[model samples]
Target: MTTSTESPCWFTSSYSDHGGQCVEVATNLPGIIPVRDSKTPGGPVLNFRAEAFAAFVAGIKAP
Candidate 1:
């Protein structure tokens, strides 16, 4: 778990326009992808391997 302060700028997913219930992502880190709740900017962050995070996103969008 990483803190929001430790990550660079984070951006909400485009899908977030549908509602505010979306996760924010920061990819400035070399090998880590920091994710946090958009509603809670200063909340806990879940760090995942960059590759793993990409795969997860792919899976979610897979039909």
Candidate 2:
């Protein structure tokens, strides 16, 4: 399991543009991508494998 005590550096997409449904992702951690709702910074965070997150993003980018 990937573990990191380092704080996450959250980044929301520029396309979020005032959308209340935005999600933020942290790529600072090793081997995992941490995701949290932009509207709820103190809320629960979902952790996903970096590779899996990469694939998901790729799929979304695909036409």
Instruction: Summing lDDT over every window of 10 consecutive residues in candidate 2, give the lowest-scoring window.
Output: 1-10
The digit string of per-residue lDDT tens for model 2 on 1-63 reads: 344658998888888886779999988889899999999999999999999999999999999
Candidate 1 wrongly placed segments (more than 4 Å): 1-6
Name the lDDT value of residue 14 in candidate 2.
86
Lowest lDDT 10-residue stretch of candidate 1: 1-10
Give the root-mean-square deviation of each candidate in angstroms: 4.8, 3.6
Note the Cα lDDT for every prediction shown. 0.81, 0.89
Across 1-63, the per-residue lDDT of candidate 1 in tens digits comes to 244455477888665684778888887777789898988888998999989998999999999
Error of 1 at 11 (Å): 0.4
Instruction: Give the winner by TM-score.
Output: 2
| lDDT of model number 1 | 0.81
